[model samples]
Target: MNGKVLLVEDDASIATVIRSALEDEGFAVDRCESIAARDRALASDRYDVMLTDVMLADGDGIASIDSVRAACPQMPLIVLSAQNTLDTAVRASDTGAFEYFPKPFDLDDLVRAVVQAGGSGDKRGEEAEAGDGLPLVGRSQAMQAVYRMITRVLRNDLTVLVLGESGTGKELVAEAIHQLGHRKSGPFVAVNAAAIPADLIESELFGHEKGAFTGAIAQAIGKFEQANGGTLFLDEIGDMPIEAQTRLLRALQSGRIRRVGGRQEIAVDVRIIAATNRDLKPMIAAGQFREDLYYRLNVVPIVLPPLRDRVEDIEALAKHFLGLAAREGLPERRIDRPALALLEQQPWRGNVRELQNAVYRLALMARDDVIDAGTVTAVLGDPAEAVMRGRDDALGAALAAWLGDNAPAHGTLYHRAVSAFERPLFEYALGQTGGNQLRAAKLLGINRNTLRKRLGELQINADSFARAE
Candidate 1:
């Protein structure tokens, strides 16, 4: 047998399909229908991996995850759940299951997880702390999977590959990981592989000695060198040239780099967090990106949800942006309930970034302090008649709109809104003043102590914002 599989599933049809697939792949699969049967099998035999369903006929598969680990401490357990809720996904990560597959999962994908689990860590993985205040906010089931994936890699130095559509906040995720990780004190150097000319990509990443080439009049540190103690965010990595990819792969493999036209090898201790809006597998097939490099950067992968998939978060995100626009010296404005409803109904192909820009534009264009549905529809370019369509019916629109898709959580939403708005507001202010806190405060017309309080409350490190602002 290539490897042993302990399959715990009560559904006969699903179990038969899984067993057939594993058996075809040369895995010796022992199928059990209940927790008692699973326990008995584990007691009598050893297995390389375990695949357990979340809802077993005789047990709750999601809750049984930890107990399964107790029975076979070294076995990597994969959770398959029909529940497929946000809570279920979080529980799977909490229990340190190697992977969580929702019901109706692709057989091939489940097989891949089982095979991959052969080399995964044995100990129940650490649960990612949610203390950073959920920077990537969306309680949607899709976002839940993303959050779980993000938590899995927080404490490790694993190279992360974040995949998402344009303006989906890929860089934000990278920044969060760096800020939350051990390298918070180090610099974060960002390089856009797509933006740089192909000719300059090498020097941009690997540095160049004086007289290395034309315009190389002085020795300059590259992104890799500057990020030696921290993270190097490589955005649009799928656009990298094949030649640069080769050098990057070699540098990553050896943990050292030789500057252009220089013989000295400099050792670098930097973690890589890369993002791409493009699907790299297709690029690899086209001979554009290197396969080995993809594996290296994708040691752990996270995919962000598009705005359409998590529209419920739009209201909160909109309110936060509205507050930000005000802080940016735009006229202070409040979004009325109907305006929020009207905002939610649009097709936001541009995702969160589009929504933010729209809100800012609305703030600038709205004629009154209270922005109503008419303004939102007008800004969204709906029919002119739809403007102020329900201005008289604004009372229940926003709350009812939110209630339709989102179950309000306990506690006041006010603090979270303030925390979300102030961090970026201060960061932008500080960045504007070259990280001089006093100057930033002066620019914002606030006392330095008050600025300090917001930063402390939000767990934001002022030093990190120094360059970013």
Candidate 2:
């Protein structure tokens, strides 16, 4: 076949016209009236492009595009819509639509689209690379999985749900999807659901009329409307309010939304890619989230692993951050082997963001060109004495636990009383230094004289607590 096309439409007249036009252009066309038929055609044969209507008598047209893209990631999709609204176009585009045509569109226009699709070369090949000149970073298996998924989803627009911890680069993943997908030319509009106030989320997403609320001084375009002919990234989606979820679901389902306090429904063309750190499944179970909304947004789920779990990539990530910092004018910063080792050894509870902050701090504070383990400890470790004190406390607790189990209540009251005073004294000093007694005393809301007296009475040594500064 010179060009193979999957022409899906419920109206026989429309399908017949499209199929005839395609065949006349020396293309082989397969026609399907329903999603099931479309799937059968998809499974049995390969096509260069798929022409689908927005509404099917049997199932949704956009949903069908998602299903087809799942099996054939690189197949181009052109949406045919009678609705002819920006919302319909945006929705179509978001699902990786190659182009959209309104009802009564000329057959020549479609043929031109088909010809363009063919000229673009093989539809099945070419892993979608990022368009922003920033390639996906990280060599971890988790990042590799993300890379594969990004390639799969690049050819088509499928509502993508990116799940990851804070600072795990969810926005980067979303940007990659938009850059690699069919709508590469379209804009990427990112919105943080959690950042918007509860009262303004709806307006932020779906726009507002001039008089929608007290603060509505002018007619404002929402992220969805602005993202027409592009991608809309909703970050921290799990933090989105239930009321906003309902509105979002309605927009997703109907491909239309009324501006806040507006009577008319405005159309918007956009692709929705949402990211969140929280688990939406349990939220659904707890009735904090809607099950239907979850299903709609979760058509393509990509989970990003925390940095600690992908320890193999830590050094690479550190280098990447350090290079970035250097370019940003922090040229004096350079991590040595010992510093990298220290980074690798420490638990990264805060993930990538925390690491980025640490690198920035190193760049800002390093006394020499090469950042050593001591500098790493100075910037990252709890004030030296605090870390030591914390370690000592852990040891003391272990010993106490062993003694309690083996030796029992013998002289326990005096020892317990001693522990109580000693623990507070150490904790106070630690808190003062940020756990350094010299620094701690200044901050203890106390004079050094008083702090010294208390430490003496409690039998606590300040020098032993000093971090290896």
Best by TM-score: 1
TM-score of each: 0.57, 0.57
RMSD of each: 22.2, 18.5
**Regions more than 4 Å wrong, model 2:** 1-132, 382-469
Candidate 1: regions farther than 4 A off: 1-134, 383-469
lDDT string for model 2 (1-469, tens) is 5689889899998889888888888999888888888899889998888888878888788855657778988778888877653345445655656667767677898899888876563245333433435444676556655654665676667899999999888998898778767777888999998889999899999889897889899999888888888999999999999999999999998888888989998787778899999988889998888999999999999888898788777787788888888889886566888788888776665788888888888888989988898898888884445447667877778667755655646767677656656566567667556446667776656777777787787677776655665
Range of the 10 consecutive residues with the lowest summed lDDT in candidate 2: 121-130
In terms of lDDT, the best-performing candidate is 1
Score each candidate by Cα lDDT. 0.82, 0.79
Model 1 worst lDDT window (10 residues): 383-392
- For model 1 the TM-score comes to 0.57
Tell me the tens digit of each residue's lDDT in model 1 across 1-469.
6798999988899999999998998899999989889888988998999898878788787666566677777888898877654456656766667888877678998888888896674676465433334356555667757755765665678999999999888998888777656677889999999999999999999999999999999998899999999999999999999999999999999999989989999999999999999999988997988999999999889999898788787887898888889999999999988898877776676789988999999999999998898888767777334335544345347446645655547775565455545677788887787778899899999999998887778776767655542
